[model samples]
Target: MIIVNSVEEFGQRYHSAKRWRRCMEAIANLHRLNPGVCHSIGDSLVYRLVDGAAPAAECFTGNRRYVEIHYYLSGSETVAYAPKPGLQRLAPYSDETDRETFSGAVAGRHAASPGQLLIFDNDYAYQLLGSDHLRKMVLMVTIEGATFHNK
Candidate 1:
């Protein structure tokens, strides 16, 4: 997991990621945006805009084929993070949605404000617990390179 505090930092680290570069370009083009699918970079990448209250811990979500970047455009939010080792699954994994919700004791909660990004890898489960209102963009990229297990 990585917490990026600014675009400069995110660029410095993940600029080589083509999908992430494309997503940033699309975000720059949006002057007037709504709450929905903003852009699809390709089959391996997707960018979405979510404006709503974050769900509960029972609704914790994890992905197997993708790593996610949650960029808080405005407002602030917290997310619960835990590894898959002992976390109890709430439902079966959905290939179509690429999400598997689980419930268990979390390692800790993380908070991000505007201009901050939460980067989650494929092996860990992270839940975005929201506030009354939050505006954030999520970039989901297909899994690639070294995983946590290998390191």
Candidate 2:
């Protein structure tokens, strides 16, 4: 996986919409390669996806040339996200309208929150539960071995 010291590096390579998606696919594969790849950004691990009659959860959506980590310094919510499906992969932005469309077929939720870190793949569809007031820090680290050859 690629690792960047700062967001600038992540931004430089992921400046384009297409390239950023590739990063998302790479990270998504990580989960398949190793389920343990999912973990908190910091200490304490107690996050899970739950199903219910809520606002479909909330998630910060963005793309970078690396795996992105979202830390919930405060606030309690559920995160629902899934990889951009099929040709619609060109989607970006975390707007509600976009989320509803993305959430059409996929599903994700946070069953519990016992820490202050949330790490996930890039550009995937996700939602936070409990409330709309979410305060957290986002970290995007470029994965190693990623190439911009075609981009």
Candidate 3:
């Protein structure tokens, strides 16, 4: 898990920091583009516009196809995160969704404030929640051999 206070921090932590920074700069473009439109820059990298009201995420899920870099531009939320070790399975992984649901105790709570970036690895399970609003972009970077296919 890579947690950074700013995009620069993100750049320092990840190899594709410059590429991720471009995605950060394109938040406005995300608003202009319709939901589900791929902001594809190159192979294995892209971002889709994502936004929702309070309690934006409820269930705990982890991804297999991509590393989830959640950069919040506005609003705030609390994320419950736990290592995916002995977590009980709520649902199996679906290739279509790239998520596996789990039910267990979260070890920590992360503050998802504006300008803060949270990156979850493929095996980390987390849930996002907030009081009134939680708007952010999910920059999905597919791992080796995996690509985000839009349907």
Candidate 4:
């Protein structure tokens, strides 16, 4: 898991990285495009604008094929995440959608506010908790050059 507090930090962290830039550009396009509409840039980058009330409780989700990044555009929320080892699978993972659901105790929670960016790898499950005004831009970038083992 990686959390960037500002865009400057993001730039400093991933200086001139093409994949990261592609992800950032996709997010910028989302800001220019219609709300709640999903967009994709090549096979590697998928992004969308999400605007709605957050779930009442944590609804943990994870993906194996992509690294998930969330940039808060408006409002605030709490993000809860935990390692997947002991989590009960609420829904099986789907290759078509590249997502799985889980239920378990979160290891920690972070207060997410505007201009904050959160990045998560496949090893952890996470959920967002917020009020009716929650809005964020989400990007799913394919994990490059990594092999996964099927259990």
Candidate 5:
């Protein structure tokens, strides 16, 4: 499922954990750093900031073992997503990368802007499209069973 919410709302939902709180704190300070930088806040929790020209076309990717939380920091973009079954595999999911590339028609598109957070689970394939200068922070968290574990 795809969830579009404010970053504050996402923090409220996952704030109980110390690691999540740390991740939230790091997100708040991401603006101070330059673009094209990636850092690991904790085990299974990665923080990535992208600021540059958007992709030329939609390249859908999905993960089976991780949940992705994308927060737009500046500019704007459209996120196109489709269910896994509707996509044709371009690359198989890898345990090291935790991502599988796919190509297909998107089910829908969401206009994303600053302060907006888009959450995607393992069942959906998503692609970011259409932006001249998009600045966003993505937090990829590994999930095990029903528990949300960072390490």
Candidate 6:
């Protein structure tokens, strides 16, 4: 787990970081491969959700399609999920497959303040709770695992 004090620090560290480049490249290829993919971008991509604009929704472990990188620009967003050292469950979107990947790290009460960047691997299961009057910008890069791993 890594944390940066400000968005400038995050940009300096990750905008050009090795992983960032690879992630961008992988995402480009992923879009080319899968056109108009809903799994890539969510309904909130590049859009700001102000307080009372939308209710805080529960975030769960997404499927294995593309990686989700959440770069918090401002405000506070709370992430909740099943804690580790427990049964080790990802997320039970359905009853089945709950016990399969039950040993991975689950995201818990994590805060993404302004200038903080949070990267969730394909397996991390969690939720986002933005603070009241909280304003932030997020960039969701859709990177295919195959291309991401190959490079």
In terms of TM-score, which candidate is strongest?
4
* Cα-based lDDT for every prediction: 0.78, 0.42, 0.74, 0.82, 0.79, 0.46
The residue pairs found clashing in candidate 4 are none
Model 2 lDDT per residue over 89-127, tens place: 334543332222233444555532423445565546454
Over the stretch 68-118, how does candidate 6's per-residue lDDT look in tens digits?
555454457776655333434445544232212343444457777765656
Per-prediction TM-score to the true structure, in the order listed: 0.85, 0.40, 0.79, 0.87, 0.84, 0.49
Residue pairs with clashing backbones, model 1:
54-130
Worst 10-residue lDDT window for candidate 5 reads 142-151
Clash counts for the predictions, in order = 1, 21, 0, 0, 0, 2
lDDT tens digits, residues 18-122, model 3? 555555566546657665567876665678755667555657889888788887878887888888885788988899878898888888998778888888887
The positional error of residue 113 in candidate 4, measured at the CA in angstroms, is 0.7
TM-score winner, 4 or 6:
4
Q: List the residue pairs that clash in candidate 6.
A: 7-115, 88-102
lDDT of 4 by residue, 41-79 (tens): 876787888888766664798998999998888888888
Residues 21-70, candidate 1, lDDT per residue (tens digit)? Answer: 87677567555566785577666677778888765454668888788888
Query: Which portions of model 1 miss their true places by more than 4 Å?
Result: 55-57, 145-151
lDDT of 3 at 37: 66
C-alpha positional error of residue 125 in candidate 5 after TM-score superposition, expressed in Å: 0.3
Top lDDT: which candidate number? 4
Off by over 4 Å in 5: 145-151
Error of 3 at 97 (Å): 1.4
Clashes of 4: 0
